[model samples]
Target: MKKQLGDSNILRNWIKGFEYCEIGFNKPPNSLVYLACTSTGRVSNLRIQNLDFYAPFPNAICSLTELNSLEIYNWTGLHGQIPSCISKLVNLRSLVITKTSISGSLPSFSKNTNLIGITLSNNHLSGTIPPSLSTLPNLHLLDLSSNYLCGEIPKGGNMGQFNAANFANNTCLCGNPLPTCFNSAHTSAPAPAPVSTTMFDSAPVPAPVSITIFESTPAPEMAPDSNSEFLSPRDLDTEILLLQMKKQLGDPGFLGNWVIDAICGFTELEYLEIYHLPGLHGLIPSCISKLVNLQILLITNTSLSGSVPGFSNNTNLNVIFLRNNHLNGTIPPSLSTLPPNLSSLDLSSNYLCGEIPQGGNMWKFNAANFANNACLCGNPLPPCFNLAPAPSP
Candidate 1:
């Protein structure tokens, strides 16, 4: 066939034989761009970057039976939903569409088995992440960052690492991996069984090596009140093994103005996470520091207010969650005194201020946890470099 055609026409046919194509514009196109013959072309890869074109020839484009990779980036003038025909590209692997105004949930790729990399960032797309996308085995690098997406990040399959920053900017995402919704009743789903760690040293250690610990001793053997359950010895021991306990508190008859003598009793409590106790309010009593074994404390979504108590005595306390309340005054620098093992401490959507505590676990969190609190300052805060150093020494 090449012998029958002129050299010039043959060259044009030869250029079209490649399995890959990239098209872009340095300036506005003077005429419509059409590659009708390229439809039957063998191109397995197509990349269109920084180009100005609206609604490219659709149904025929997806007909590229051997197409493998497709990328469309930084073409702001191109507006509309991604062509639904994209799912027909049976051999497509990597699909990237960034900095475009494509507004839609990612179309399902049920038949596109070879797909691996998918990114649709910086778009106006809205709606939940399709649960179907989680089923892809070879797919990796799913970046939906900087979109107007909402709803919980669906938990399933091998979704690669996700974080608040990746799901930030979007006001409606929540649950584990991301922080729980600000004003919701979703219970924390228990975490998966942890991977076991091993100690490598074989040498015998000294006799008094380290102190062992239990979560809590059983409550004094009181007869079962009509409101409580009678725990058998085994059940009681199991209760003692829980590092964190969440007990529902019902209101005891006490009207508003009476001097509420004390907060609820928790003698052996280690990590107390109190939620939805509507009757509990007023000052967080200073006596809470009595629970020496407490390592984490979260008092969220309540009406409790007043100054955060000084918990300087609880040296072992690592994490503290006091979000979505009306608390006031500066966050206690005493928080910085917690043991170095502290990882996450959320104080978001509150009314606290003053520079963040220095030289401790506070460095692990980002500033959004301090959002809605206008006066807070320091590293996590934006314009953070403008913050002054902690008072010298």
Candidate 2:
């Protein structure tokens, strides 16, 4: 470590070889000395790794108008925004500053297309990468990973050629290389045409997809088209239901609760039937109340598991058949009291409980709709000795 210099005038004579300088980072002196040396235009390289300098950040180094390479790694106590004046170094070829406390945007390399390599990863920099950096002609090494940066990974130029690991660990990034962002709009939207899979996915086997719900004409099972690849097996009926519902509820665009919306999108629909939709998970979403004109809804033999959704707004509903699934929770009295048109509610083969609500249209259904739920009670089943819910442990 160099001792702190008291006189600034004698510092210029301390300058060493023209290609490398590791002295300043270990014991940075007054900012005046850095400016004095770099202004001489003879210092062309900097390699300051783990600099334990006690002095403040010397932004004065930007005066190195002839620098060809600059690397400062793991230098403790180096704090402050990277000076924007460094962009004036039009002769720079390599620039790297990793594992530091540098908190600012990247220093644009003065449109100097001669840049060869860069590594600004593992820092506290928090901003979008400059797309113009890709314009550098000779750049081959790039690593901007492990930052708080968020945005679409740029697809322009040769940037896509880099491995996905080069830009990983950032949230909110989406595009061709990464998975596409959530886009709903499924109805007349065309399915992706058959494209060669080799260029699209690098994985050995295609993974199960979750959110690519689009509409397409039915392909014959005997001679299925390579283009007709849907994540759901019941695509034809779902398509028909979507097309029919599309005529009634103008396309609302698919979201997380889309399956519920699609089933209930029929304001003009009278009878709806569904069976055997596999891998159905999550709570039954609550938008089913939007079906103002639905009278009969029957869904059986599905893997759906969730509490019964609100039927308060579905006054036109006459019969609701949700059996042979793993639905839980008490039947809300609001379903019987609010929907003045409800007559039949089949919640058999589920894990429901509580005294059956005794008001409004609930009395119209017989014992069969309430069967198999051992915990359920009231008029049709044996009365529970206690109406109050058991206290939580």
Candidate 3:
């Protein structure tokens, strides 16, 4: 890193440094940031990345009051408490430090509202999340995954917007987006397996063979935050639409009022193919429409009974094969709005009809792609009535 810093210049009683910011211990494997300059009060953007710094972060950082972004990442052998003095940097907008060995209770961010993102994942940090972090008006993303955090997650404002995947692989986090923390969750609810949308319905109904009916319970008491939404649905009723476990998904706004839930947390999911599960039925959850990142979706040889799921948001779709299912509906022209990345499409052996939208990416499929849809039409298949309309001029 000395090579990256080049020759240094001295100014007055302190040395104003430039670009001592990025240091890595991986090459020769021994350099660490041990800044000891007299405070010149000039730091605006400090990024310390990929190093073997195992010491408490330099206290001199507090003197850099002008700092707006402090990024510390991938520190190996790092073991120390994040100084409480961090609250002194009232100008900080982004604080990201992941993959470190830093351990301790999380600090409060109530002193400032400038923060936009906070990433403290893959560490040994323990204790409940500071509920005050939720009240930051500009806060957008908070990743506390893969830590030893215990207790319930804060569910208010935008806190409920993150995917449950962001909170996965942790120790004993409950309520809202995660499983309920109450004993009522365990004793009163015996949910069955295959997850469907009815799970979020509020009407008094018997639990389906695939879902356990969770008796309602008030959410755990939360740390007070005036900016937070009033806890109305209770922690257990965040009204989550949790599918099966083992699949990470949570978007409480998309789920239930009793608690937080999501249909599928596979935000960037590219490939999905499930088949031959007779226990699966009903129209594919309308929520599949939210998987905007979906690329390959196949529901073949199953008991899936629905109109083909709409992929209007999933423009990256490259292949879609849904054969030998119990689906019936007109092929949505909206599928034509999908990205032209489509390399193949097979909607055969289902009960479908109507002229295929030959606009945009739809005509790329051939006869085999729409095979056995005795009631369908357009190119690749016989036209609905007369010949398929000529390609647009």
Candidate 4:
């Protein structure tokens, strides 16, 4: 029994080989000293920082099952995968390994439900973030940024609390708080063909075209041979939508570089996302509903206000994220009628109010989907109440 209390000696032996790491007893004022044990003599916390060492992550440390927090910071020479055995530390409440040369996939922490924070930034970790991590109910702070991770971020549990910056610089991380992921079928599309006089000379002219140039760009001088047959009906619709969007959004300067013709050329666009643009303000133009082929619509972290636009015409829309905005007014009841393929929806962190439209695909979402609104009420949320009529007055 006396040998079991000697866990501190075991910890010392594990890190003794690392150059410049000062092994110490309990918490001290010095930053180099990195050990702290519980009253029972169990090693409860280990913080190793700024140590100059070239070694694979020490797997021996995972033996300390009593550890409550494990932090390894700025060890640029530390490499290899985070040891999977570390998950055996069921008491671990925080696991932070940042600014390291660690490579390989993130380990599963499904058993570590006590975890409150995880910061694995600035590493070479690859592959998708495991869906099991999102099931950690107490996990509120997470930073997996600056890694080679990809695929849709799991949306269950507390993931909605995090924003894009937490997952920034990952190769292709998507879903809520980031852009929607594109399926292989919708990966790439051809750019719109440039306008030419000979385009209509060979094909039958479909319709008369009208063009509106924004003040940001100088209007092109009409050539002597230029005619009204320059654009097709599809092109005209896209141009009109862009114009409506520009006018409604106050013509923010960030959009100055968007080539109108090139954007209009994506006649088969399946996904449309506008994210993290604080300068983007005003109501979502209702004209956006005209995009019948759009399967995902995400416009978040902007200053856009006004009611949620009706998407009755967008039957193909499978995902809709309009969170973290200034939007207000009741969720349009028409949304309740969207097809069953409308699987994902989030309107949280906005100024929205009134009963959430119930029925159809809306039943699939829970309180998290409509959370942080001004005064939303209904099933999934608390039931709405009726006001009593005034008495004799």
Candidate 5:
């Protein structure tokens, strides 16, 4: 590192013939004096990892224009906005910063074309994830866990391969594959109130959640309308749900159990998620199975305690997440018969017991998903296994 007290610009970018440089040491007064002897704007392919450069002058690091790949790691004391100049690193491909205390909204990176991977875990940053970041087609290993990020997860990206743990601990994040926020309008209605089993069993009948959809004739293809905004019918359904939630929350005496109604109201919904309401209890309304359109259902960390409802008959059902609840009873045999399209089925952290369901459509997931449940048993778990009987006794 060099510093110039007088003039140092005439010789910048003339690094003789150095291709890469790494500066991870302190810059004393003498070092600063020498850095001045050298010029700027020529350093490229630099890797200044694990340095106190940010401490002496955080703004100093942003001036480097030749960085093609930057890794600022183990520098926990760095703070403030990543200078907007970061976008100037047009050739930057990999940006990795771990074990830092940096805070602020990540700058918009829509202009970045070559960036392929970003790892910003274990930080103190907060804000909604920019949907633009989701547009990076080459991003493969994004680790933004353990941050203060809140809001609905941006969907419609090709993010199907990432496991749920990649997003674990971000309690506020909602939507597939993340669980829906318990207080979001979709799940804001209080959970079903507890009731005596006899009362439920003696009822004349359970009202099934149902919706009738009339197939309409297809519209003729036309040139794409430039100004037309296409609103999905499902989006309209969610808007109506939010409106109902707002009205209910406004009236103090309004029924607190609105989420149950929300679930019951959207029988035609193809996707459903409810997450993180500690006070929510009682059985999942049996009426949910009546939703023939249901494809993805996630209900996590509620006060719900009951048998996993039978979906044996719902061939359209695919992914189901029911972790961290009071749910107990044997693994449903009907789940084994899920349609071939089914991929993931997580029921971890509950009171569930009995042999793990070993079927064609389900059980493809790893064993960690079924952990913390005391009663579950299968090839992956011992003791719950039936002991081999003595010869033919």
Candidate 6:
């Protein structure tokens, strides 16, 4: 009296019965294609890529409650919102759906505590990114780039470690690892208290009349305090640096109490390291190149853009790690001429292009140092085709 296929076989049957698209596998025992099941016959992983099919998100896939990883890529015809029922897959860890026509706001995955990575880039997704995403404790890799997401980026948790490229091409999105939000009302902190005009007004004066009429009076100008001390050149420079950072980085909480003297104390700084600071956006401060005594310059995992600063002045520099940033433009040719003291360099994961300069310490590093760039070529990387000799007659 028992059914032919028991409850444990339900996920397997769903996979076989699925006909919305032609599923193919790499070296299939055809029956087990496109999916991997747990010993209990529950589907645990599903990956479908490059299939030409026109269909909405396959909601039936959500029924595989044990599913831990779901990846669908380059399905140009795949459309519709990622079904909310996906949250039902409590074991879901990694969800990647790229190069599709999927459109919708990212759904909340509050129940999926084990979730680690979520990449939904290169799609038609629109709407503000949910702030709750920042609260995911185990979440690390998040790439929502090339979509239409907008609004301020959330601040806490591991969000500060993600690369700027992860959020690139979303024109409307603003805040850390991207540009600062100009709209004051949307900022995370409360707006500054309005200035009191009454404090600047002169005391009310009675006019010479039967009725007590008030007369307009001019406020007296205040004199500068004689006890105020003049700031030295070093102190002034520190203040300027602090203000520049504040203007560019949008005043993160850790920097709220930073005073000019705190930075002035580091006048002889030899190794300056700035990492895991997501709010650290904007160009590499040209003044950094002026640190003649600096032996190491490490600024990684931020949204720093523009060309790499000229480090010719830092003759003592031995290590430079500017990886995982939004830096564009060609590597400074001068870097190849740096003194032999320069032994380590890492400019990977940036938008840098053009040929890798030869000579000097450039020969010391390998391909890994210059990997993941926009159009980098030469020695350490695949040679630039443009540099190839003309095909003879």
Model 3: per-residue Cα lDDT over 3-67, one tens digit each:
22232121111244543322222234332232211135354555454554345445666666666
Task: Quote each prediction's TM-score.
Answer: 0.38, 0.38, 0.41, 0.43, 0.40, 0.44
* Tens-place lDDT digits, model 4, residues 196-220: 0000001011221222222233434
Instruction: Give the winner by lDDT.
Output: 4
Give the local distance difference test score of model 2. 0.53
lDDT of 1: 0.52
Model 6 TM-score, 2 decimals: 0.44
Model 4 segments beyond 4 Å from truth? 1-33, 184-393
For residue 37, model 4's alpha carbon misses the true position, in angstroms, by 0.7
Candidate 1 per-residue lDDT, tens place, 205-281, comes to 12211111112222234443564377686545544433222222222222211111222244455455554444456
Q: Say which prediction, candidate 4 or candidate 6, comes out ahead on lDDT.
A: 4
Off by over 4 Å in 6: 1-33, 184-393
- Ranking of candidates on lDDT, top first: 4, 6, 3, 2, 5, 1
Please report, in order, the local distance difference test score of every candidate based on alpha carbons: 0.52, 0.53, 0.56, 0.64, 0.52, 0.62
The top-ranked prediction according to TM-score is 6
- For model 1, the stretches where C-alpha displacement exceeds 4 angstroms are 1-41, 53-59, 181-393
Question: In model 1, how large is the Cα lDDT of residue 80?
Answer: 56
